[model samples]
Target chain A: MTPEQEKEKEEKGEQEEQVLVLDAMKRYRNGEIWDFEDDMAVSDGHGGGENGVLLGLDGGTTSTVCICLPMVPSFSHSQLQSLPILARAVAGCSNHNSVGEIAARETLEQVMADALSKCGSKRSSVRAVCLAVSGVNHPTDQQRILNWLRDIFPSHVKLYVRNDAVAALASGTMGRLHGCVLIAGTGTIAYGFTEDGKEARAAGAGPVLGDWGSGYGIAAQALTAVVKAHDGRGPSTRLTNSILQALGLSSAEELIGWTYADPSWARIAALVPLVVSCAEAGDEVANKILLESVQELASSVKAVVERLGLSGQDGKDAFPLVMVGGVLEANRRWDIGKEVVNCISKYFPRVLPIRPKVEPAVGAAWLAWNFFMKECYS
Target chain B: MTPEQEKEKEEKGEQEEQVLVLDAMKRYRNGEIWDFEDDMAVSDGHGGGENGVLLGLDGGTTSTVCICLPMVPSFSHSQLQSLPILARAVAGCSNHNSVGEIAARETLEQVMADALSKCGSKRSSVRAVCLAVSGVNHPTDQQRILNWLRDIFPSHVKLYVRNDAVAALASGTMGRLHGCVLIAGTGTIAYGFTEDGKEARAAGAGPVLGDWGSGYGIAAQALTAVVKAHDGRGPSTRLTNSILQALGLSSAEELIGWTYADPSWARIAALVPLVVSCAEAGDEVANKILLESVQELASSVKAVVERLGLSGQDGKDAFPLVMVGGVLEANRRWDIGKEVVNCISKYFPRVLPIRPKVEPAVGAAWLAWNFFMKECYS
Candidate 1:
């Protein structure tokens, strides 16, 4: 084809994609098209389901999830589990550090919009919103997010903002903050809280800051091994062939091009499954990587627990240790999460491990309920 | 200022900068304004100096350099030292993997233009051109570059394309392609060639694929140590204070923002000197990082040497080991280069280390001379 024809074809393709996206957005906004939320709709008489909804956002480097829940004022912590999830929505990264402040804010706003719209609710129906997002290291970050959230909802709506790790902790503890949470997804971080509200954290500085237990870090080390083996700098391992074939590459040299072509942390982290598979197959190098990752992850939790005194003065006091994310959730024979718990148990014998039944976004919604109730009754 | 006014001011500043660059380009083309080349202009009687010139380019990730040398048909290899550099030019990155293909080509072309113009020479007077560039891993990369080089020069002019590591090796060997060369600047790679022309390379896959002997890798590890210390995961070290002050950061949390802010490997690699300083000051963490880097660097060289059989069956055959880049030239109290050499010497006792007096651009020029002469005489 001529250059003009090629240009025309490209433009047509772009236009079609844009139209499809717009149509999807329209259908999504009209959530009446989906029966998932409608089937779960309840008419509880305690001014819970129909009276109001809570928006809980867990914004991370990989993706942002918003969970809309009925604002049920549970008298006991166990009752919180029964709260119906009114609507759920997902979007791309909302971490201010990864995506700039404007983009991050837009993502948070759009996800909240989608959740509320899906539940056939509006901003006016939102009783409270808790945005627990990654990259919220400072009070300034918290206040900035809160200020923008104020712009989205009415002044009467209650707002609570915390680091995304807080939501992960709350997820396993049924909204109680007095526990430790170890998240090992594309990145890793350990955060802990005491009964009296004191808090401490370890890791969570991203891959460059040496969160080696993270999926990104584990996969990167695996890739490095492939390179070293091909170049004769390291012992030839099964990983070279395993990773090369998984990536549809013929040689280890091509891995370099494949890596930098798109330096997204998630893309590399996606290879964590293959690493696990290799380790399960008894590849020494892959097993070593997983073992090292477990140690690194346990160290993060230990650091947080020791600092926050979660295991008490005698170090035998029982404390809930929330395990979250893909790396931790791997239940294969070479289970990274099980190994991490075992490692942690050596230091804190009373470490009570909990794998949350719900996701972190629901934990955020629970936090919204807790914060709103405390303000109203206390 | 208002947004519109601020944009206008920014546009105005950009225009001024563009004008200055254009003016500099004009002055560069009118290289007669400088007298460095004029003072060395010799009219030798053998159609050597006044007859023609050779162009050599060393294109790297950080920068690209072009060297212009008089085409002297020297009888002996020792006579190559007497050849005077006619002109020299520098430009930004020309690695197509780092930059796009068009931008890399433009930079190469412009730098060549600058060198020829500075030496009061034209394409017609060029006897040969040798381009030694980074990211030339495949034969396809070499062919693409050669095709473009062909478009620029006359059919009579001979051209050669090679990986940037070849120029580095040639630099220490004085244009010979035998023995091993190890470069550990922002990245690390060991490349070797046998007397019979069998060549091999190790590492140079970059930081992701484990060039941990690199300046970038050393610095990144140091940063990780600081984060570990701050988060209570590792032992306390002097690197925390030293690196934080060097980077003008207030806290460990700030280091995360500082790191991903730019994400340029060179920017992170710049911290290598600080890490060395910390090691010299008796910081154990810093010392360990350097020691590991030493082993990594030495391993790359050993891999290349053993693969090429630079050491004969007795394992004591003499071979030139070319050491290049800032990491090797540190000359610090805790010398990394010295340690690497010491490590490699245990395996190959007759390893002769040579630090090149001339830059790689000159080596590229020497390569041009070698290529041109061989074709004419053979």
Candidate 2:
């Protein structure tokens, strides 16, 4: 197809996606999605202090971050912008999918206690709590989390729980709550909604089924390459020496024992930079790993865009492509982001992927603000 | 390099390797290596009854096999050939690298008890007990194993401990106490000795550091390819469907959870037939996986042959390339054995690879016989 025809086709698809989002928004406002007042108490605006605060948490596969900040009313854009981060704390992984229930609970509670301690806010003073966890993809997941987290706050504090992708998208679009969020950290998943409320996801099944372009995925590849070289089944690469040294492992044999014994996704993810450096130093295997990773991430973004019928949208008309997670962040120095840009450019030339302006905890705060403000306005 | 030149170079390398093995053997026989009647107790020729028996155990990464038989003396080669397997029992993994110490010992004990029950013999009736496990490579490992096994055997029973590779070599050569054994079971490792008694190994570190062409290795490759296909980073393969189905997992994502929860190298290796079938059905990825696996096994076999200076030895003089393990057995139908033979033909045209005629446990029994006979003659 000619570029002109392709552009026209893309515009039509974007128009369709916008319509889907709008329809979903109408359904949501009509009380057709996500809640009931008895199970989840939302916007019971009467109880919180005058300077009502919302605790926002972004719980990732490998780590969790919590931020306490004052929540403002719906109409105040400047208030949303200037809202101070009262306290911020980071903790180890709390995702139930990755860590067991007890570990996840401990990490979450630790971060919550730390944040509350820093902010000096009593349970009564807290107005709302929003936790964006990577595995909170279903209503059942959210409800389980709500029950678990109820002990951390006063009975009246409105609780919001959603997957981290929601906070990620909110972060890039300033809490508009629609558009794509592509995550390539310890795990990889792309999720988003059109303005019309049509939500979709691509990838994010984790390392077993999917999780392409994730740090774990990259590390797995580097390991496979190293072993193949050792067995004389694959080409030689400098990754053999660098990966072992970077991980502080004496021999490659120790990795299985270490991984299975403790099971740390974050530690494996931490090896991405070493791979990136090797790629930069012209190691073919490393370069191949990066290229494949780039393709996986781009494909994830494209999957969401296509599912939302927003493929080939013009740069101006395209949904904001929010990129988050350590893998994407690590590549900021390796020209990989540019490579990512180029791969997705065919389907999204008018769009550009950018990291969140604020930390993910702050992004969760923005999601809380958006949730409450939408309630007040509706 | 030309084939003739390559052959010549391989011969020289083999000569060097053979010399090294001879030197090590000399040192061992001179009481300069391993131990002197401490951790390992060789047959003192003064144990139990006149019709004393031996218990041989082959402890693999995933499975354990125990066989009990009468130990005929040095002059009874005919008796050795006709000796029946009195009892045999299979148990769970006894590899310390894969399972913890307690689990390994429990498995060993369980299998031992089961075999003894079937044979209708008391622990005292067993004059010698020899166990060969895959992961017990170092002298320290052997020492630890010796200490662990002593509690299971009667005080009068002579106990010998060595790695499983020794038993594999023994099985192929009918207890020759020399030549190479190639194991491609749940884990991969090629081990052999020169005629002069120099022992060496290539690969077999387990899935983390080595074990290429192992069942675990093949499974890892299959998983990687499937996920890559799902994400469009690799070609599509029948493996994507076959592997999931074989594991009773609906999606690839569940494999990570399945693997981490149970962590069975043998379970993963069990997928080898499915991969082989897919390759037979013309799945490019599956075919590629098999081809690579074939080459790795060949390379492993070649490593041992060269080290023992048996590279070009023909007929009876050639080092027996003993192929053991689930993988080698599985390939009997796939002509993978033929493929393997072809790969190694250049270096060892006169020698051929063969599966053991007897069970690996029987090989352990043979090792016990050799140990006792060596004591009697020396």
Candidate 3:
């Protein structure tokens, strides 16, 4: 076709599509669209409008809750900052009694409300709200969070809530349907999906049981090493002095008092990187601890791959492995990241490391959009 | 020859050696002869005659020091119950300030007075005094302990001081120079010496760094698990409930309070075995911790062996590994011991397991006797 004719044809199609888009947009703003089948009422600019969608939510250790809507345009910087508002909105109705939980809910709600208030006219036109949060791993917990979101927004708003790990996986893979994602933040866990929709997991028992190689694990190890060194049992590492100075205590007795008195355990765990840095500086004890942690994390990943039967028997491409969380992000260019990658590569041939690009909130928003699209089309 | 002819020949030899034997026997009775020497003293008919001497002392974590001279023929139930006279002799020296240079001088005076009181008519005839102690790690400490004994006896009185670990090693090895020794009572450590005088050690870094597989480490791990479980971040192990019950604590806060209220850290460590027992009963989390402890200890032993260059192509005979300590004694016949042994053997061949047969005090005495013999020979 001539360029001029093609342009004219496209413009005519665009005009017709704009009418349908405007009508659907109005319905969305009015909170009248409840299911994916609502999309049928809108005309496809293209003769065939593909409506396949996938929903993802990331409930993170730090962020509390995040949602994603891939069908919608990515949120602007201002909108992204409004996540706290979204989080708080969902958390406000959950009836959480703990002070920490309550604080987190309030912070999330305020942040989201601020962002939505700024968006003003644009807020009502958004579709879907898929949330992923930490501690929402159980089916009941997941439903409670989803119900809270539904209660705040219009009843027609499609919502999906899942453990934050899902968002990490989606973020690491950029919403890919396959590959493993390891999240090593305050805790450690690995989740992976196969092309055939099969899923496998390892570690993720939290700081006490498994969470190996995580920040919390490293911190705990560092504290234990400090105690051992003080007692003249372990090799001296800089962490001994660093931890003592950080906690503002002298003598082992005083440090023990500080640790046991308030039991701010997570703060103690956050010192793992400092321990890692010391190890990298040739501290024998620190190195030993880091080595053990790396081995543990690698083992967890290997287990996930093995359990999923992802290893190719006939030299096929191995499944991709991506790592997410502060450790991976902070250490991506360091020896620890290299070591983790090396250890993981031993078990699988086709390991793909995707630097986390989407914040878990973005992943959650993607999920919300997918949920809305699925409801509108189905 | 007939019996008569054999008797006649023996009589003639005895007649020829009578003076020499008599002199040797006299020296033996005075504790002035070494039995391992090529030509040693023999016993005289009189009690004053020289004969073999045995000295035994039970050095404990606390200050219950016992000294047995001419080695008691048998330890009767009543005799063992009554405190040894030597214990009373050093009772005044058991205070904390009774250590170092000043305590050494005072202890020396008291020991001399006690010896004089017990000597009766044989005050000048006594030859040697052996003292066993718990912390004779340095030559100065040994000398200080010995000087106290020397002050109590004549200048000719030889003195000895050795740590409890040495005694335990000697006892466990049946006085063998080439064997492994594990000492696990209130604390734990493992040591091994070869016939060629090469030494290797593992764990024994007191209750802190290297006692990975020890009871204290187990208890610490269990306690950590309990804290994590209580905080809703760790997998719930039977150890969590069992430890709470053992400590008479109904909540985490109470447990934390009791654990850190005083210098009662050791008391909390005492609960490790309960965790182990629960682990043996199929508590997944407890079992994992135990298994990790075993792995750590085994790795320590492997490192020691590797450091000594005792493993690999160059060594002729495989190094013998010994198990000492209360934990091994309690678990040696159990799966943990078997697993440890199996794991160790994988790294080093020809591991001979032997229990200690001599107290470290005896080893110290043996060392003292050797020193005396060397001096006399020189």
Candidate 4:
């Protein structure tokens, strides 16, 4: 053989050896995971539970939740609000961006198994599954997740996958995907959908790429203001005293240490309430931060609505605007959600605001029912 | 013993055991590190080479540099610009915030040792050492590093510690501390000192705390603009095309994935050139970003100058404005450093902008000389 060919062969052999070791490890793990199924009685591929069951999962950076609901044949679409939940299981961090793909997949699978075990249902008894996960940005992400689900379920079972924002929107609209949903928790994103299946999103890129309307963003700005004030770059405000006392820090310089000690976005976001309190107490800097945040949040919703044409061409159309997350749930004297709603109303006069009565997991379960019905009955 | 007392004793025992293990490991590592010193012949805590030597170290997030200079007793302060550098050594990150305290200390110690060893000098032969490192925000940070130096060198070796910005300032002023220094690289900060030893600083807080003039900040805003334009939240610009092309991304959506794949500030900051390119090509969005960054950079310098009274009571007195870092040395048609100088000149028209002829490590060495002379001959 030529020297180059010989080298290629040697490298190929080493790669094959590595792949074999990885495959063996995976098989062992899969065997241990599926051991619980061996105890079940053998039956046809049909469901064991009455009318079977539907699985819905809402996976996020902080936690993954799987909800089990009965696929009652008699229930109509109008009764989505009354759908009874069979079981729910919770697990930690299923966002592939936060945790690696392998760990995220394992967490998702375990959560689904836990939910099924709680409801005394097997995989054959699952009729449909809808997974709404945080990291599902591209079609590739959705297809990869669908492939994983296909491996674990019978081919006859229906499956759907979407970004977690879809679940939030569905929760507010009772499974009808035709409006904009704004989520402003530790991070922020605005997602919208049309009834005919077109969808768009804005500002879910996390803190680095500038989701400035988020809880983390607002708190970070407040901290910056405190630093600016202490360093004589900006006007002094009550935030210096209030934030320092709240954190039990002696000076603004300590904030740098406190911020970088742990890079968790949620830890910094927890200071949002203090910012609100300061704004309510007439701190101009804090007030300005909140006002800017309101504008930012409104802009996100407006962007989505404008992109999806949820607002009609003339801009006078009634569309549900689902508002979720801690930043919006602030029912304070200086209500952020209220201000955002008002700001958007100037551009969209008929914008109907919604606060989801059910959690996102319930929305995912309803989505499973809806997607299954469409595929089977179309 | 009581149950609580027994529990406390057990916990204390575990803590002691852990400390002992860590201590033994540290001692072994330290022994390995200083083994070269043991091979050297013992010398008096005085001159080994002619007039001995002085060591200066500039420790930063990216890299650490140590410069060794011969101590010349006859050289006048006016001839400081021609100080001889005996040796130079380089090391990786020595910032305590980026690398842990132990690792940062080891890097600093190793670099200094390497510099001394290269020049055939010992710690005993060292006159004074000035370590100007990043992450030295508080007096406590300074004290902790000073304590580390105390353990490394003999008591007679006069040691000085300051923020890395001080070295940059001294570099432009030829070791004089009476000037303002503005550093705008991956991060940005403005530090100023008066002749009477009064000092002030502004905007040294990292990107989270709003160092908006920083390379990281400018690049992040550019990325944000791309996302906004893609999502229809902001005006479409050349940045969307320029940044995506630079990153080899197929679309703006891919930018999110590329960004979160690695959380390194410098990695993102590297995109500053692309933003600059787009702006120079007449992209309004990119132009606006640059303008805002210029204002932010100028604000920091103004804040420091005003606080330290470096511009005098009328804010028109001449003071050396030392400019350093890649952001300032753009040398392009759309020069960010030139704009910053122009902006600051409006308030202090006589602001003398100086780009340092020597690197910061050499400035640290000069600082060591000045500090040593003041202490010994005062």
Candidate 5:
């Protein structure tokens, strides 16, 4: 073999060794292996209220929140919307899959107790609770969350649970109880039910795989642009200074350390505001990133609309499209919202767009109220 | 403020907290913070060879290799080429900055001993040793490496050390080392010396900030594409399956876990081969990725060439551009080499591309030779 080929063959050996060496680094010189800590949140059950209210909890990757609403046995959808929210509470991350079971349980309990306290209600006053959590994608994941909730609340308290996407849809509909919700928080996804009760979704592949048009996606693009500019591989952008200042770092080099130091998807996603601010300041790179995100999200709406067959026919009602999450909700000034609306309108001219009338937690409570309310009317 | 603004303000609080929390995590959970271990490599002192041969060590972010070259008292530039290479050795990672210092010392010792064994060279007979290590970016980083090396070798042994990029440049030009070397391994950079000895560099920034057209850059793009395809935000490709198979993982979801599990830059960079193979197989996504990488690399070369004023003039010598690292050097069948050559030639047609005539270790030795040879001549 030529010397070049021999050199290549030898280099190949080292690449293989490099991978094996990493596996050996499984344990560090530091003997401290962190166990999943259970004391993730604080809980205080100190309040009193009237009986027969249903509680709704929205537990997500970063935080958990709960809202309490009075359940009227004979209420219409309109009355359900007008019902007063007794209390609300928020706490730390409760993504069981990502953060571990004990941590999730502790955070959920904290939020639940805080919500019940704010309502001046004892645990016994709550008639039922519905928890719509992020990361409840599979049936097994859903069951695991239900099991955790069951262990906390009294056995007699009725409970319901689903993916947080369901809460997003319910919140925007205001108990109308049908149609699609497009969420673009740190991640992005479009999910909805057709009038025929069939469900469809697009995107939502999570941080590493998908999350197009999401907060993380925007931040990632901004980072790439900044790096490219720094390398002279791409055009210049204001994202570099904005991102560094936002992170309170001094230089692009420090930004690398900060990014990899934790490398949490949510933490990176939080930088979306920095990008948005840059776009607002007329940074060409930031504007391009935002436009691309809007386009991707619009395409998601198109896919879900096609998949669920939610297009409005002649004389039929337009498909309702509820926009949620930080990216979509914050897009009014930047016109990301307007662009998405325009792009999706090309496919479904009469598609109705709605923002949530109540908090997602309150919507979850409304769904819980509807569960037994429907039974009473039947 | 609007509720959305309030939410944004509240999220701002969390982002600040996230930054602080990361700072707190700077302390490793393992209390046994590693110090540079001195005795990592076993010193057999077993081999003996003719006196006055210089030793060269090229220690990179990956494996470390060593070369031994004979030094003649009255050798000219042409005569230096005729000297036989006395020995060679290869060992695992010796990058004190990226890998811990202990791992660095251990691998260096192993390669040193193995090379000496091959050359039958005793420590007393070797005239001098030059080490060009990856991650010697700053004086402090360089001092750390020197301090570690000081502990390993006797004080009487003459020594020199610098970043591996220097060795890469020297390897291509032999002893007449002037002009830029463009590298696109797991990382990327352009470094060069003018005839008068002034030095300049471009695009050596690490993965997050720059390293344009590097293996890590291509891998990151491939990863983003795979995710986009999976989510329907982009066209479907064979990358998802190929990447999963290459990593020996089952699902795309598992990739998030695997990626962040250790998240070493080289580990991710190692996946570039998979992308190249896919591109070779006519995967459109992979081909696009390759083209972008080549373009970025070309831009880096352009920046460095312009910075150093290495552009060819009517009466001046043709500027030499050395191509180094796995991504450039391994492109026999794939044509990444041809693409880079074509791209750079567009900017300066007289630019010369030279592959390394000697291993980087041999170049390091040549540098050591030049150090004393010039001293003797002067």
Candidate 6:
């Protein structure tokens, strides 16, 4: 064998032979163990029936650590059954600055260690780990996370880290290589990838810049509209009453208090659907707001398509559009999806709508597996 | 004479022989006062006779005082000079609460005393004192102002007080009793009197309630549109750039400082015309804002007409609409006045567009004269 092939074989053998001493000791001592195999299935067609392995870790803005061992093509059912999944929410790690990311990494490592101990696994037994986190956008950020992971885990374990948005997109596509995904929860953004490896993005520049058609946008509109209505300068929409009721506010001064006191911009954004409901009920003011929102979202999509040069022939029919966000998914009845699809179809004739199939954690795991499996087999 | 007629005769004689002490004192002091008999003409056929008297006072939100004078036929051509019209803008007299109104009355009393001292004559020498003031529609408030005026002035002096809006309307019509007049400087309101003495009003609730199509309204719309544009959620308008440039602001954060530090809502409202200018220059956003403002104003007029029950009535032709206010008067190039006229004409076929001939203060004086000669007489 060539040197590279020998090295690959050694790595594969090492992985196969690896065992969690803690789990084996627990079994020998007759300790209780929970198995995760029921949640995952492995294909039996490759590598002389050796099960493929994957490890995913999601470090989100709100939640800290989520670890999963997903089934791969080569892993047997019994092997999968022996593994365990763990999720731990790290407390208070939402810093957008540099120091915050460092503190988050330390917390992630500690959580992973605790989760592995609970699962009766040793650090050496893990073949790969992927971390999906917020603010891991730049190459330097990725490197910091990877280095931190290497320092915590055994050298044999490979590490991959990416932004949470990437994982979200991947989860929706179930590992699909090409598609567009829109995330509209607290904030709104659209991202898409073409088959030719071109990528485009729009909105989601944070709360201050863009994030149009999101909960924040909706809340802002509702608030402004209420003020206008109160002043008798705007059409009297049902949203005025609804918002006042929702906030339990009687005056604009009360609203100022709510806005300034521990403001959950996302929570405020959640009131958007109520406005939409009023609009659907034929309230002119509410309808105007909704129409404006629709236009904003359309503009975002158009911007992405245009930016990616997806308008011309080379970009057509190259990717399916996928939407995977709490707001967009929850608002299926509102026809937001239909509106988006129609808008996109205006420019891209062969637009295909695909529902996301996998959780973002699974995407992270898939990415880890792809990165590490190639390393193992060379 | 019977006791009642004798009392009436006595009151009439007193009113006819009395002279405004302030006018007489100013003429005596300034050495420019002409002899009343030599300079004044006899009754003109059109409303104003030599014996016709007018007392005009403008009681603004800022101050309260009176302009007491006798009217001569064709006084516009008369060159009889007088002291700078007795004017007062009493500080600390805003009627936000009932207490403020009481305080304003006390202040007005003091102001009247000061004016009386300047007049250098007995209080009984004043024939009439007319007050034009920002008035509350509530009868109690109206009675409060009138009672205060009566209490402050000598019982022999005929006292009259009406809203500044009435004064403005009278000014435009040269004391004509019927016509629509729009007041649109810092705030906007439309008031009209029908031939049958019915009154109609629109807008003019204040900056917080309505004031649609006024300077304040325009500024508010422009600021809101610019903020929306900054978020990429509003239609792109030229106002966005122009506003930032005018204010010397780079971002929305700078706007917060302006809002919080020395926040002058009226100053912000003044930016509307700049936005209108941009719209006229072919900025889509500016154009949209201007169109919306025009629509709002038109709607206000429509509301007034509806409230007055002028629909399907030939009497509508009798009260030609008059446009006033700084915006309407300043922006002659814009078609807002023409558009309003056109809109009104849709409802009233013979809607005449008449320019206001006198100041609103004159209207107040006309009301005062009417009260002295008619309502009080009856």
Better of 1 and 6 by DockQ: 1
What are the per-residue Cα lDDT tens digits for candidate 1 across A235-284? Answer: 88888888899899998888988998997898999999999998888899
Error at A263, model 3, angstroms:
2.8
Score each candidate by Cα lDDT.
0.87, 0.74, 0.55, 0.89, 0.75, 0.59
Residue A112 error, candidate 3, Å: 4.3
**Model 2, A378: alpha-carbon shift in Å?**
6.5
Candidate 3 residues lying further than 4 Å off, grouped into runs, are A1-61, A65-112, A121-124, A226-232, A236-259, A310-315, A318-320, A331-333, A374-378, B1-80, B83-332, B335-378
lDDT of 4 by residue, B33-151 (tens): 56677777666323336588999899998899999998876777778777778889999999998789988998998899888877778887899999999988779999999998999
TM-score of 5: 0.78
Best by TM-score: 4
lDDT of candidate 5 at residue A212, scale 0 to 100: 55
The ten-residue window of minimal lDDT in model 5 chain B covers B27-36
Against the true structure, whose DockQ is highest?
Answer: 1
Per-residue lDDT tens digits for candidate 2, residues B289-309, read 888988888887776666567
The sequence of per-residue lDDT tens digits that candidate 3 reaches over residues A61-173 is: 43343232223334342343333223222223222322355454444444443333332312233355566666664577767666656655556546666666776776555
User: Per-residue alpha-carbon lDDT of model 2 for A231-321, expressed as tens digits?
Assistant: 4446789998997777678865555556566556667777788889998899999999999989888887776776676644343456578
What ranking of all candidate models by lDDT puts the best one first?
Answer: 4, 1, 5, 2, 6, 3
Please give the DockQ score of every candidate, comma-separated: 0.44, 0.06, 0.01, 0.35, 0.16, 0.01
Tens-place lDDT digits, model 5, residues B157-234:
667778888888878777556888988888888887888777767677666454648988888778878766654556
| Chain A only TM-scores, each candidate in turn | 0.84, 0.76, 0.71, 0.89, 0.79, 0.75
Report the lDDT of model 6 for residue A367.
57
